[model samples]
Structure formats: structure tokens, C-alpha cells
Target: MQDTLILKGHILHTPSPTQLVAISHGYIVAVDGVVVYCGKTLPSSYEGLPVVDYGDQLIIPGFVDTHAHAPQYCNRGLGMDKELLPWLETYTFPEETKFNDPEYARLVYSAFVRDLWRHGTTRSILFGTIHKDSTVVLMKLLEEAGLSALVGKVNMDRNSPDFLIETTEQSLADTKAWLEASKSFGPLVKPIITPRFVPSCTSELMRGLGELAKEYDVPVQSHLSENYGEIEWVSALHPESDSYTDVYYEHQLMGQTPTVMAHCIHLSDEEMDRMEETQTMVSHCPYSNVNLSSGIAPIRKLLEHHIPVGLGSDISGGHAVSMAKVLMEAIGLSKMKWVEVDNQYAPLTLREAFYLATKGGGTFFGKVGSFEEGYELDALIIDDTSMFDANERSLEERLERWIYIGDDRHIMKRYVAGRLVEEPK
Candidate 1:
């Protein structure tokens, strides 16, 4: 029988909307993972089980990062002053090319996974380099580290450095092979279709990938409307398509599979409507947008349209793995957008931003991002005794402070599916 572990803390469960759940098991078998053998009181049967008490600490679902380029971990903070296209050409492409070396791939991939744990991000959707071996290395590290993630082998056939580009046929063949090889790894680390974006992927490649998504019943992740120049480039490349979103729709990559698009910064009504209708997800990378001057994503508009939106670090581009920082950045950027762009687009409230980082993104995985009954017990125990006072704040206030002011130092314990995975060094 699996050993039962009970964790007591101020649980921030993202059930329905959001709530705190008492958590137990490799699964959250009861309210917040607690199993009651008798009445409301502690049962005699559970007396032998270990109960870890986190006094007044905030316990939340491990953050779900919906979009990031894991392979770019080495290049973070290097080309911050440049815009998207130039940055990609000069720094990003060249850095990604180095992943072709399997040894180098292992070194960087290990660091990336460690960093994810250090930042308390238990689950994520990540992009890997183009080389098959390098991508496989990334998956191996994630599996070893016990992180839940969806990683993709980037597919780019054109408009890229020669070292990074692939023949369209070769790209498809390699992608299919990667997906097939990934099947044995089980649910923790899965494959996602990553086209790089519309400009780099031909219609044939996109359509073929869409077919694979349907056949395998897996999720697809890629960039969309991230920069003005990129959007124009996509438009010029696909003249027959109505807009950037239409290009993906034309290839049947939209609704048939779970799809996540990064940065919907300049979407039109038609594009927004299509995303909403298809149940697509958007990853809002505020720091990346600000860093590259890519323009702020219309998050308020997207939310109003009932689209699923989540936070992304977009590492290298965004320059941080801390979703706590991303949460603060998201709020700050939204306020800037509302003030400078339009008053109608109000800033995201602290609660709304927290919801996006935890439960909103956690929804991608069933019953994640909350402490509700029967939910997976993926959570983090934070220690904030440094700021505790005789006259204290509420649970929400503590959460807000953690998001705005806290870092990995506050994460005392990290748990996934009720299994203790990482404890602070």
C-alpha cells in the first residue's frame, strides 16, 4: 500500500473558482489529501501516518507555466536590449543551435529542470531545441527530476539560421519519431507540436503536424501575434489566409487538439472569437513582451471573451523562471496597458493574477491548481515567518505578498501527487 502523508497549511485550492483544501496520499484522496477513517477527529487508524504541519504558511498548487523555451535557459538575459527578430537572429538562433551537441544539451537541460524546481513550478509546457537528441535529453532530465511537463521538438523549415533549419519532410519525420519515442515515458512528460511559428513552418508542415495532433490526441503549442513585424511577416507569407490566427485554423491546428498560443498581443475581434470558440489557451508573457517591446497582450479582452489565459515566463525572452515575478509583472504590465492604451482595459486585480498563475493555468491538467476534494496533491509549502507579526494579514494578503515580494526562499517543501519531491537546500 502507498504510504499516506498528511500536510497541513493554509491551502489555496483552485477548485471551481478557488479555495483552500486540507491535503493527503499520492493522490488528494480526501479534502486537501486527508482521509477520514472515523469522524471529523483524527482517526486512530491514521495514527501511524506522518503529518507535516506548516503553521500559517500558504500552500498552493504548484505553479503551472503554460509557455517557455527550456532550451533557451542558457541565453537568458543576454539579448534583452534587442527586439524580437534581431534578438532571434543574433542570440536566440545561435544559442539553440548549440543544443545539437548532446553533451551540452544534458548540461543545460539539468540546470533548467533544477531551476524549475527551485522556482516552485511543478508543471509546464516547454519548447526544446530542433535536434532530436537534445529534445530527448530534456525529457530525460524532467523525468528524473519528477516534474510534470509537456516538451516539444521545435519545427522550423524556413526563415531560420541554416544550423537550425530543417527540410520540411525531415522536420515532420523527426517530429513523428520524437512523438513515438516519447510515448513510453508516460503522462509526466508528453510531446507537443511546436512549429516555431507561422513564418517558419510551411502550410504542408503545419497541416501535417495538425494531423499528427489528431492522430496522437496530444496538445500543440506555438507562438502567435507576438510582435508586429512577425505578424506582418506571417500575413505576407500566407496571403490567402484572413489573418495570423486563420493560418493555424486553415491547417486544422486549432480545435481538434488542446492548443496553446503564446502572446496574443495584437489579436483582432475575429481572431479572439475563433480562439474563444475553439477553447484555445493563451500564455501571457509580460516581461518578454516588455523586454522586446512586443506590446502587451490584451489579457482583459481575452478574459472577457472567456478564453483560457495563463502566465508564462518565456525564459530567455522574459529573463526569469519565477512565476511569482511573472505574476507581479503581469499585474504591472496590465496596469500600464490600461493607463497608456485605454482606460477600458483595466489592470488585473491581485486575485485575478494569482488565479491565472495557479488555478487558471492548472486547469490544463484535470483537478490541478486547487486544493478541492479529489484534486491531485501537487503543492508547495511556503515559509513566511520572516514577515509574520502578532497582528497579521489574511490568507489572500499573504498570497499577494508572496507573489510580489517572495522568491524560492519561501518555498520550504514541494510536493507532486502527494509525493515529497524537493525540499529546500
Candidate 2:
């Protein structure tokens, strides 16, 4: 039977990167987890169909985290003093190495899953440690928690510490096995191809993984031009390539399938052109960019080039999981970028950052992050009455205040695919 759910609240969503659509005391009707109507008044067809009235609460699309490392859940807020490569060698690798133990993976991932829920992230694309068992544990936990994600078992075959690195053959075999294992998961939790960036993966491994990505028809995620040192290192490793982005493109990792590259703080004109041509998405991780001393990405330039852009928490490196805070940081960083570059790029507006946190990132998952007809009904019901919220404030103003100052305490409820998502066990 097709289930129908009707909700009424102060609705807000971004239909475009620059537009915010708000409806006071709005009604949203979803049938079988897809939105059919959203407007200021209940349509007659939906009348008397048992409305879930939220009164004065704010109902908005759930956040989509385009880039995060599941195994780094325990590493947030640690080792922020160093730059990207050193920080990874010192803190990230050691922490990720521990995930080889299934027990540890479960303990950490359970909390990570709960936190993603707490932060109102209904969907995410995450990277796991090389251990296939541990990666699968994350998918299972997310499935049980009723959240959605594209979880990857990370593959790194070179230039990594011996303890965490995988042999080329083992990496490919494990990844294929893991991909096959992922078939057991529900639709909400599926597998993604992760190569852990070019420096950590060799030509052989990248080629093999790219072939597998095509065979399995799964989306790909990796890092790109995140730090100057990292880009320099890539140039040294692949002297024949034209640019850092060229390495991934040459390996068939970028243009061959649906891919989302994180950081992208230093792409050249050629790289940007290729990105636009291939329709690859950039996961703009503002917090991590500053935290790791990675320069700010030319997000406005990328947008002008018509490249897809989205927000990412990049936890551990970023030190936060809340997309609300991430979007605020994104706006703040864009302002800084505008000042740094003599106003060549306009700073991002509140609506634009909100779009990145919603439909901007949500585009990766198809028909997500909005109240438009045919969108998946992933939403957050926020009760800001306790936050000194005023009656006269507009919905946009209230949402801005919440983004700047509110925490999970203001989130009263979360919905994924039109179903109420209870706290994870």
C-alpha cells in the first residue's frame, strides 16, 4: 500500500542557489516518501488525510554531507595545529588504523551515526578505513539508525604507512569483495568508490578501482588539490600529467562516473574547465580549508564556471558535524575570499550557503534537498521557541539565527523519506 503523510509547519527550502521559498503555516504532502505538493494551504485532495501539525516549528530540508571520513569520528578537534599532509600522517592515519578492529568500528560508528542524526544530516557520502569489515559495520549502523548514506571502504595502495596501507592486489580484491557485500544493504545505505586521493594510490590501483567503479556503476569520492604541499607532491609523483586534476582524469576517476572531489582549494583554470566539462561536483569543505591551513577554494569562480558545488563538514580536519555551522563558516569564508581577491568574487549569500547545505549537496543523491514535487521528503522539524525566537521574525531570519546560534537542542524531530527517524540505538 502507498502510505501518505501530510505535515504542516513554517516551511522553508531553496529551489535554486539564490532563491529561498518560504510558506507560513505551509502544508507538505508526501506519498510513499516522495513529495507531491507543498504550498501555503492544504490542497483539498489532502484535506482530512490526517495532518501532522507542527504548529510554529520550522520545517526545512535535511542537510547532506558530501564528504566525511567515518573512521575519523573519534579524531574531531584533535591535531589541528599542523597542515594537511603532516596532520594526516600524525593523527588521521593512526586513528583510521584502529578501525581494523570490528568492535572499535562499531563503538565509534554508533556514536557517529547518532551524531549525524543529532546534526540533522539525513544523508551523507562517507569514507571508511581500508578494513572492509569495519566499513560494512558503518553501513549497517546507518541502516539500523534509519539514515541514508553512500559509505565507501577506502582504498590506498601506495605512499601510506605500512600499518594502514594495502597491497595493490589486496586493495582491489578487498574492494570488489566489499562491493559485493554491500548488496545486502537497503536502498538508503549503499557503497561508493573511494581511492583516498592520488598520492596514496598508484596508477595500477587507480586504474583497477576506476574499472570496478564502472562495472559496479557506483559513484566515486576522493580528495583533490586540497593543499599546496599535496598538489606539489602529486606533481612530483606524476611528472607527465599536466596538472593535479589531470592525474585523476587520466586514471578515469573523475569523468568516467559520478564523482565528488573534496577540498579543491587550488584548482587551476584547466582543471576547472575539465571539471565543468565532466560535470564533477566539488565538495567545498570550508572549515577544513582553514583548519588545515589549506587555502580557501575559489567557490564563486567554480560556480561561475558552472561546476556543481556542495558543502562538506570534513570532520576531524573541520572539527564539527553540524551542516548549519558549516554553511555559516562557508559564508564567512566567502566574505574573506572576496576581501582577499579585491572583490572579484562576491561573497555567498545566506540563501546560497543554505542551498549548498540543502539542494546543492543533495543533488548528489537525486531529487533530494527541497520541497519541490518529486523530491524525497527528508526534513528537520525545529522548535526554536526556546532560543529566544520572536513572533515577528520572518522564517528566513529565524533560520539565519538558528544557523548562527542554534544547536541540536533546537531540533525537535527529523524525517527521512517521509518517515520519522527516531534516535539511533
Candidate 3:
């Protein structure tokens, strides 16, 4: 493949949360995997560069799914009527246990990656079950398909079912091995330490993993304050901690490394202060929050605190994989928070939601989620003619329609690191 490529399309990207940069007919030039130029017209200096003209199609930064469970793909859209704990026991754990079989993990993860690409997700932070080999299988599939990800071998030493539990010693050993094995993957396919959450991981295990994270210089991802029941359970489990965020901090999981805690829907003022102080990130999963009857996150407040916040699919908990769908749910849920709870926490703008799905979440992966110069070109090409978000709508209006109603069918092509990503066979 040529190192230099040019593309012409209707483009949309967010350089800032409040700003939506759109060009009705724009051209993007990339070379050696970095975007060199993106503007309304083809640069005159590059006269002969081959241009892939996707006339009238929407070209936006690829969506980033900041938190997803690869093993739970099978359980999506099923058992959603129940809340968090019961749903996990009945559907999630049993389904995740099936990953002990490598072939099962292979099938599920392959389909999951293809679906992620089909839905225009170019990067993600994904969780695998406790099976070490199966988790590696997920990483390999992601690497093969040209997707960027932080794939973790889940760590849970207690409070899990007997079939899924691990000894603290065994868990730490497996995690070290998993990290060592991940060195073989492409640069984009890195490993992260995942302790599952406060309830599942014992303090000893979290401390060990925290040490490993520091030693290896790897980032971490986990759930936080997702459910009231889960919070109560964590409180009961670790009474010495001042708050849910404090538990992770006390164990050295939050502040010592890059950490993203999902579904921060319920947090105390002190917890918020700690999160803001530590520069800890939050993966806001609006669909999961509402689906599990968890309270809507105070996203406006988080943004107000200048804390880094991004959108997540929260797979299985969130029934959809498309960030477009997540964006819609996020905006609607924000409205509920504003009218139903506090007017000071106003509803989120469409621009802000798009930023969360793209640039905001992309910050986790560094220099992704935009067409800015020198940024890796992970982009999506879309044909939204059929949806008509509105008939003969302006480019911005069409984008809004896509956010409100588009699906994978609207995505014509996807690219990661300037290389086109094909759907898995």
C-alpha cells in the first residue's frame, strides 16, 4: 500500500467539546500514518496525490468505546430488564465463564471485533474474563483486525462465583504472564490492569495489581459507583475506606497510574474532589446507567470540575455497540437529569456528545479521534443518504440525524492508523 493517500468527503470533527468543525466538501491528506492536511479544498502543492473521493459522504473521526467487556458480547440485549447484581449473577457471569474455552472466546471476540468495526469503533478499552489464554485470544483478534485496544485479563479473587474465582496468588501470576504475553501484539494493542471492581477484587489482589501496574507502566480500567447495591456492597466489604473512590486510592490503583472508572453516576463531593485532584478519568455509560436503574451521572458537574470524561458502550449493560446510539442516549439522559433533578446541570449539547464519543474518549489513546495534523488517521466514512436525518439537510443537520438514527449500515468504511480496517470473515 502507498504511504501517501488523499481523501475527499464531507468532514466532521471536534477540536473542542463545544466546537464542531465541519467542511461540506473537504480533502484530507495523510502520509506515513499521520494526517498532514485537512481542509475545505485539496492543497495545490500536492497536485498528483491520489485522492479517494467519497463525495457527499460524512468522514468523521472514528468512534472510541472506552469501556467494553468482550466476553459479554453474547449477552447483549438479553436480561436487560433486571438491575446490576441480579443481572450479573443470572446472565453475565455464566456467559463470561464460557470464555474458559478458547474456541468460545475466539468466536465471541471475532464477532465482537467485526461488530465494533462495523459500528465504526476504531479504538476501545475492553475487558476479558479471568481466563488468561482466552483473554490473549481476544487481544490477538484485535491485533489481526487492525483495531486499537487496551485488552485486560480480568482480576477478581473474591466475591465471585466459585467457578470463576481465583486465588490472589494465582490472579497476580496470571496477570503478570498476560502482560508479558501482550508485548507480541501490535503497538496499538496494549495491555491494561483490570481489577474488575471493588467487590470482586480483594484488597491484597488490588494492591498487588497496583504494584504491577507501576512496575510495568501500564494503565488501568475498572468500574466505580455503578450501582447503589454495588456501592453498598463495596462499603460493607471495605469499611475502612472513606468512599468508593478512596478504596481504589487507598490501594494505590487510581493515582499511581492512568485510570478510567466507568459509570461514575453516584459520587460524594469528597469523591468528586479526589477524582478531580488525581486527574482520574471517567467513562460515562448513559445507556447502562438508565438500563440498570443506576442514577444518571452528573456529567455536567464532572466537566465543570474539568475532569476528563468520555463515553462508553458498557457492553451487555448497555445494549448497543454504536457510539452514535450511545451519543443519543447520553443527550436524552442529560435532559432527564436537568429537568428531573437539577436545572443547574443543564442538558448536554449534541456537539459535546459527539466530542465524548470521538475526541473525548480518544484522549485515552492519545492523538486519536480527530483529523488534526500529525494525528493518526483513524476515521469513518459514512453514507447517510437513506436516513435523511432530514431531506436535503445541511451537513451539520445530517450529522445530527446520523447521531439520532444512524447505525452500522451507514458506515461505508473504517480506518485505523491510516490503514483501512476490513470486516472479519
lDDT of each: 0.83, 0.94, 0.91
What ordering of candidates by lDDT runs from best to worst?
Answer: 2, 3, 1
**How do the residues 181-218 of candidate 1 rate in per-residue lDDT, one tens digit apiece?**
99879667888889899988989999999999998888
Backbone clashes per model, in order?
7, 0, 0
lDDT of 3 by residue, 1-425 (tens): 54987889999999899999999889889998789999998889888867899998999999999999999998888887899999999999999999999999999999999999899999999999999999999889988889999998999899899989899999999999999998888788999999999999999999999999999999999999989999999999998999999999999899898899999888988999999998888999988998888889999999998889989999989989999999899999999999999999989999999999998988888888999998889999989888743347777788998877778898999999899989876
Model 1, runs deviating above 4 Å: 16-49, 388-390, 423-425
Model 2 C-alpha lDDT per residue in residues 1-425, reported as the tens digit of each score? 99999999999999998889999999999999999999998889877789999999999999999999988988899888999999999999999999999999999999999999999999999999999999999999999999999999999999999899999999999999999999999889999999999999999999999999999999999999999889999999999999989899999898888899999888999999999999999999999999999999889999999999999999878989999999999999999999986499999999999999999999999999999999999999999888874467999999999999999999999999999999998
TM-score of candidate 2 relative to the true fold: 0.99
TM-score of each: 0.93, 0.99, 0.98
- TM-score quality measure for candidate 1: 0.93
Which of 1 and 3 is the better model by lDDT?
A: 3
The residue pairs in collision within model 3 are none
Report the number of the highest-lDDT candidate.
2
What's the CA error at residue 57 for candidate 2, in Å? 0.5
